[model samples]
Target: MSKNEKYSHESYLEYQGKYKGIWGWLFSTDHKRIGLLYLYSIAFFFVVAAILGLLIRIELIAPGPTIMDAQTYNGLFTVHGIIMIFIVVIPGLGAVFGNFFLPIMIGAKDVAFPRLNLLSWYIFILGAILAVASQFAGGGAPDTGWTFYVPYSSTSSTNVIFALTAAFILGFSSILTGINFIVTIHRLRAPGMGWFKMPLFPWSLYATAWIQVLATPIVGITLLMVIAERVLQIGFFDPALGGDPLLFQHLFWIYSHPAVYIMILPAMGVVTEIFPTFSQKPVFGYGAIVISSIAIAAVGYFVWGHHMFTTGISYWSRWFFSFLTFIVAIPSAIKVFNWISTMYGGSIDLKTPLLYAISFIFLFMIGGFTGLTLGALATNVHLHDTSFVVAHFHYIIFGGMGFAFFAGIHYWYPKMYGRMYNIKLANIAWGVLFTGFNVLYFPLFIIGIQGMPRRYFDYLEQFHTGHFISTIGAIILIIGIFMMLFNLIYYRHRGAVAPSNPWKGVTLEWQIESPPTHENFEEIPEIKTPPYLFKKES
Candidate 1:
């Protein structure tokens, strides 16, 4: 195609394709459009889930059915976990940012399966609809928690079947997206970009996609098993009904554990892309980072058993899992050290993205260390069902992945929208969000150590102080969240027009027009150096 035809003056947002208006986006095969679709949908689900979580917190503030009854609270948390885990965090980054950038970063026009990409979003929507509908579909929300632990899930009188169907369907969507990314990375990388020559974001997604494809089937089967047991009177999880509970745990966690990586790996990729760009330095230990990404994925698969340490697992099994758990920690630590070293002597820019990246390291360290604590057999026994697990989880998911999501959005907002959000406001919102995040979860670690169990709507008088403080923090967090989101939303059209390469990023996306053309590249660019060559840019 000629340069003018290939690099249209109109952006993807403006390109009038075979369809017009909303239909243009609905049936569109464009990867960017699909990414935005996922973005909008995920954002809505996130708000719903977050509000559910906040209501749960409100109920816990005074310890005695403050705002909601026990059954209502159980239903709230159950739906909250299902929405946050399945709809929000699981597909948050990879589906939104991954769909948007993976092909562009790899120097391709779109995914290996553009049609399938659009279909994945459709599946995602259908599954999300089912998940939410479980709340009001005449039976009330499923109270099995997001994990849907077997006996309770299989026999629960609530809407367990609807939730199970939703989870199963969502897993299918995840598998398809993963397959699409894997094939795209393997086949469509720009000419001259070898395996080692590819950027870290795609590498991260490459590993994540493998985990998604290889591991998701386990959960899909497990969810199906639960649904079958519920509807067909089969015995799969309930011990009284000829099923083993521990077996259920194993099967559920096998996928759920790797699913953690699916949630966080791309976050890692987003920051990996950010560190070098903000520091104006080539990524430190590129080969090490690359290997660690793959290593984490490979090692992540075997560590699922750690989640089952407390379930009367054999002595040898506990030790084996504990050892592998620590083994998995190695690569993550390498990434941390590599990230810090990348900034050690480099000209670091404390922009919005970097601020979030730096905060991620701090929070992830807390979460990672706490995770290792949970991995220990003795501590696992102590904290497995305690509030500490809740604290540690939020730190990792909200603090690590959520902040990284914000950072990626701030970093790429210019390129994605062709406009610049107010930087001062962005910085202010980041500070508020970070502070609110800590205040919200840090107290749980203390209260958990003090013996407060998770999923409880009420607590003893001794734990009352911590819960109260955490509630206040939740309110603050909501404020900060609204502020950050408002800044981005309001600026979509009113913000200053952004330059093509605002951050002066060395990647090919930076070399292209803002809000990249319908086809990402005008002509496929040949890569001849490391992806983050700051010296060349300087």
Candidate 2:
């Protein structure tokens, strides 16, 4: 950065608002501070869920009661899924990076409703607390396997009510954020920035916001129905009470499947930003990527029926869902092709961020293709509840969205914190994390094909080898997780001071001061041309 840029403004970290120390952060409506709050909390839940997942892998190593009993195993996996899916996956990227970067990228000071943004974070915490409290309060931990399917959830003597209430509350937070982002994007762009000229990351968020606004309320009401099913003895999903169990499935997956886009669309946005910067080239087919993001969100809604294939739905329904499933894959595939083409012959940086971005494509492709197998009616019946589905879900969520989270953090660390981490160490952690992920999940596909059902505490001797190998991979994965987290944390406050535009990024965020001032721009920029402009590389 030039000397003129060095002493211009106090970074957000140093800016003292009305409230002093911790209180400033706790009640502040500053979007960057709110984003950091999400970063810390979501990172905590990720490690929490990851530890539960590791213990799960350990228990399955030898097939018969390795570390925990059957009941404990079921409860562990249920809580793990609840936390990872509801808290970590749904809000991690959009709440953290999107909150921090979206306004800045669009040349605004903060989101349209800054106080509403802060309130959403508090609601997220409240819901998260309730979800965790369900494990230990009043009754046994919920064992409905995150699906909380039907009669069992209704009748189970556990804290299912608490979990249900928690999820319901969390949906409110999501809805508010969706509303906030839509208005922010619509009203806050820099003066000459038209929709087409806006960056792709914001476009992905735009599409995702619509899904959040429209789809989340369905599941929120569905959870209330389930709660009523148990407390009011209503016949919502319980068949014995004259309710169709499939009703719950339909309602849940309608929101939950689009919730998949909620998790991934912003992740797609993050990598979309990374690819152009790291490749040192304008994105290939930018308009197509923008369209595909919206396309994926639109098509994602109707494909939920594929998850219910074996539940005895009608033939036409089956064909409709299965067809839509494949159709949805077309847009996702378009994104992958565009990413690769973006890097075709450009000056690829091969940095830690790029590495994770590339891995996301590889693993997400595996997940997407495997998704096809489940989308086919015949194959869906075969793989419906198997370990194969488990592997595919992780490959998509953890491998795709999770890795993209890492990439976004690394790519934006310099700008967000005004410090730099050890590049050599970051790259090494990436390799270990990548290797451990594939080693752990890839085996499940094979064992699942051999007929190992999921949610089982034990398996036959035939599946032992795959389970054992997967367990070891989990161990390696945990080590890498800590290693990566430690490196980032250690450097967050102490690393070398970062330049304003460390990656030579051409976006508005890179043009501003690192750890930007209270008002992002001293004066809002007027955009004259499209984004992703390039200068000669060193």
Local accuracy of candidate 2 as per-residue lDDT tens digits, 1-538: 3222333569898899999899999999999999999999999999999999999999998968988899889899999999999999999999999999999999999999999999999999999999989888978789998888888999999889999999999999999999999999999999999999899999999999999999999999999999998999999889889898999999999999999999999999999999989989988898999999999999998889988999988899999999999999999999999999989999989999999999999999999999999999888888989999999999999998999999999999999988888899999999999999999999999999889999899899999999999999999899889989999999887788788899988889999998798899999999987888787532
Model 2: runs farther than 4 Å from truth?
1-8, 536-538
Error of 2 at 154 (Å): 0.6
- Tens digits of lDDT, candidate 1, 1-538: 2212222379999999999999999989999999999999999999999999889888888868788788888899999999999999999899999999999998999999999999999999999999999998877888989999988888788998999999999998999999999999999999999999899999999999999999999999988988887778788888777888888899999999999999889999999999998888889999999999999999999998888887898999899989999999999999999999999888888889999989999999999999999999988988988999999999999888898899899999989988888889989988888888888899999999989999987789999999999988898888888898999999887787777888868887898898899998989999888788887554
**Candidate 2, overall lDDT?**
0.93
Q: Show the lowest summed lDDT stretch of 10 residues, model 2.
A: 1-10
Every model's TM-score: 0.98, 0.98
